[model samples]
Target: MMEKMNQDGALETEKSLKRNNVVRERRISGAVAPGAGAVFRSVHAMQSTLALGSSFESDHIWKLGCLDGSSPDTGKGKSQFKSSSITNKVCHGFHLVEGQSGHDMEDYHVAEYRKTKAHVLGLFAIFDGHLGDRVPTYLKDNLFNNILEEPSFWEDPKTAIKNAYRSTDKLILEKSMQLGPGGSTAVTAIVIDGKDLWVANVGDSRAVICRGGVADQLTVDHEPHSERRRIEKQGGFVTTLPGDVPRVNGQLAVARAFGDENLKAHLSSEPDVRQIRIDSSTQFVILASDGLWKVMNNQEAVDMVKHIKDPQAAAKRLTTEALARKSKDDISCIVIRFG
Candidate 1:
């Protein structure tokens, strides 16, 4: 069963898993203030229910918020929610701030929970776009759905995530005419029954988990300089000019990303996938775009918010710190606390 609250604040229920793919766009005209996006919360308990579309549903409460390019707010917002399982309590919060780049916010995120027949899935991701927000927006709506649709998701999650990322990149390339000549870096995490976590990434967006008070990075940052051989083998060159990071073919900065029709031949969208069993030593997980990582190290971030019990406040603190450090890129962050 699926329940969706539309823009009019009306709840609509669907009995089946089959649903239309509708892209909802909200246009904002002025600078958006901090925490100025659509915020909603849903609560559910453990039950033997079918998976409802891509939205969150279960016995636990989850909060989600996304800001597309339409918001006029100086590109800042926050949202958070908490949920519990028989073994652990899960709570998540996200914060976003548009950079001083003089452009609309080009970062998007997803943080919610869903119930399958036998498990509760915590789905979270960060998509950071360059050139345009279209690719990231598209990812926000479709990437996780495609990953879950893979036949091997349950038995071979690593392969399933890789296949889904490749296929999704193909779709984005095919739709580049509409999505624009841009691309997005993605980092995704799937937590099963609040215990098993599967993380995958393409490009720089990163995922870090805190275990026993130490920060363990779960995602790889696919940088052009680090993967120069791969790019050169594909007839692409990595360029390093003064005052600029290495770039593929002197164009894109990352070696892997979704979309980028013009650079498709040089870039790869294959994600590095990793899986870990969540246990007692696990404290929390952090997912954020390069904006935050550019200013803070994994340990610094983990330490800054480890003492903050509220996940939402923790997320905000990270973004606020990044801004204080003079990070000039759009910043997006998610904090998932496990206890």
Candidate 2:
């Protein structure tokens, strides 16, 4: 049965401020392969320097970034690597968390959290790799910097988001001959200026928010099943015989992704961005990968965490529940409790 909120379950959880940050790196290094473009310079350092949701208000922000993720292996199948000093900072609130385990030895992770202003701003990101883990690792290290440094960031968050996704995807592909089959999926959420939020997704990872304890999925699952209607509308063919999860183009499960040179002609990495302003009705938020949603629905996740009264514990509980359900993919999650 699909997951959902139990009728009698009334979650009333309230957490003041609990933020977790994770950062690690990939040992695989030595400049972009052989002919990759001049490694895009670091654009923006993680801005833990700003107090986005601190003394000025009652908000909090936290994030977790995984440098080495579970993307596909490299050309020789020797895991991709990165310079020890390259920054691989990823993930943050906007209520979201992603963790990686069982990956090869070359990867690392890092995270940060802060509270300032009258509201909370959370940053959450997930980088799923392919061909080799290096591309995703590079994305984990530089995606945000690309976003923050974009000229449109402050003026037009949505356009900035679209631009960042394209620019980053192009950079990865342009350098792929050197990196070899280099690519990854990126999903990000920014809870800005306090009550407003912006979500951008490339690939299957997702972003879901809670309002008055009810979950409102902000990002769409870019899966074959989810896109069947649109796919048909676009003159694409799909077998709906229903056996196991739906597949796009008879291979991948997601309708879009980053750096799938083979799929780029048909698939897309361009993000679907959304801007939402918060009010008193807002409650909390959850951001996670397909591993979590594959086994649980938005409302079910919200229902379980709502009454917990502890954001961190609730986040873990959600992960555990997904595991028990036997989700095949690596699972990661983050929860942001609001005032």
Candidate 3:
């Protein structure tokens, strides 16, 4: 009888041990479950953060916008527009590349098509800034609007452009504290009905048109050296160091620019305007900042991208070529094609 009791006791002990083991395993699993869930949640949150970062980069880095209720492609610094007129069939594209200057891109551009009651206007511009991007950003946002707002825009676009540029500079100078103590070089092109092209510029940003398979520069580069007489007449001296370009008062490089509050007395915000009739001989027009012009001439840039059928590809090719040529300034380019 004692042997049978011992056997029963042993069986009960084994059952208790099994039950205890099961309870312990359940507790361990319960403890690990929350930890595993927390780890999973952390990984998911990290992925979400990474995605948000990518979106932020895309939206902020290449912030191209169209004022005519159209959205710009935020993938890269590229934009394009086509005219609505069947007879004209004008198209344009632009590309921008940030330089290796160790600063944020100080170049801004505008390439948009606006429809009015009578005509479709293609407006394009480049604002190359110094010291800061605030001035250029303001120009990109407000310059064309100010130009179109002028009452004499339709009757006399040149005077209208000049007045608008002057007034805009005044406004910028008036708000210099808010816009920062910086300045910008501007080149603006307005194409009306795809036939009449009005180009204006201040400073070194240039506009070149290809006609009869040759490049015809339509705008003048307002260099400090060339305009030294005027700059000195305005109480600013042009200085040229041994290995540096000419600068006004040993500071700003361009003789004529917009929004140089400290140097406004020495600078001229007046733009040189030219109006050209787009004809069969006219092939394309290129508007670019000095970054491209510093390395490539008007004819060379024209020849390099003349064969490119797509304007976007042409603009990209020009900027890519500028980078390949070791241009270390922010490069911005716009190409308008008229067939």
Candidate 4:
């Protein structure tokens, strides 16, 4: 496996380098207000020039109307839940432009049933992919399912989530040939018992909760500079480019992610988990790729969506705002509102 990885490492590193450049540009450009609705024409053109592979169409792949907390199985792409135990609204949106590959991945499973247990839960996640779409796509399909299958998920969720993350990373490494050399940052939110929320993350994808109209970050970003100690201890180095941000190994910007077999020795898939008890103060939660985060802070995002009423519109506004600010990465987001 090491030998095979060595052969592909060079090519993968080159791809990661390009993606890093895009991220660096976003950082260098300060945050643009949500009202600024002008798309950075040059940035989009640059992204198109660097984009590899076939382009995907931007049709409404799936849509669900206002579901009044009746069904748990409302197909894919959208769902809403409201009951005595929980009152929540969920909405997801994505972007796929011409001449560019849509690499970001997202998934939300509402009222997911347990095989042995009789519990129903909701799972929401956003994955930011670099190099290729394989890693994020795989995570969108498997990560939540794997966490549910951990058996101990109901009793000790933290342990279950941690184990699932490591096991899933192993699976990605073992299947690298089919999954490719790409990697992805992930942020996942699990709502159980209808009143509690558990969030986990790896890399820069983020989860933020709006409590009393104030934004509270649920997960910490795993960037190269933030995890310098861990990286150096693992015999890996983080490098900073002039006028740019720090990157892991001078290649990948994120310090932790799923896949990236060549950097697995230094990188970690172990997620930071946080548990929250929903109350009157908790307005809504936003799980999004870095594209939205690159241009908006926690308060700005919450402020933009607090009065929107519709979760889908809130998510779309966030993504659209990011693009307007010249964000070059694939943007995706999931919004969940609680009563």
The C-alpha lDDT values of all candidates are 0.71, 0.52, 0.71, 0.62
Which residue window of length 10 is worst by lDDT in model 4? 24-33
User: Which order, best to worst by TM-score?
Assistant: 3, 1, 4, 2
**Reference-based lDDT, residue 253, model 1:** 79
lDDT of 1 by residue, 1-339 (tens): 000111111112212223232112111111112223222222111111223245442222122233333222212222222334435656676666656554445778876566664566777888888776778879988998999999999999999999999999999988977788878899999887677889999999999999887999999999999999989999999999999888888877789999888888989999999998888999999999998998999999999999988676788789778877878777878888886
**lDDT head-to-head 1 vs 3, winner:** 1
TM-score for each candidate, following the candidate numbering: 0.77, 0.63, 0.77, 0.73
Instruction: Give the per-residue lDDT of model 2 (tens digit) for 203-230.
Output: 6677788888778888876777776776
* Model 3 stretches with alpha carbons more than 4 Å out: 1-86
Ten-residue region with minimum lDDT total, candidate 2: 70-79
As a whole number from 0 to 100, the lDDT of residue 114 in candidate 3 is 62
Which order, best to worst by lDDT? 1, 3, 4, 2
Clashing pairs in 4: none
Which of candidates 1 and 4 is the stronger one according to lDDT? 1
Off by over 4 Å in 1: 1-86
Q: Which candidate model has the greater lDDT, 1 or 2?
A: 1
The superposed Cα distance between candidate 2 and the true structure at residue 41, in angstroms, equals 18
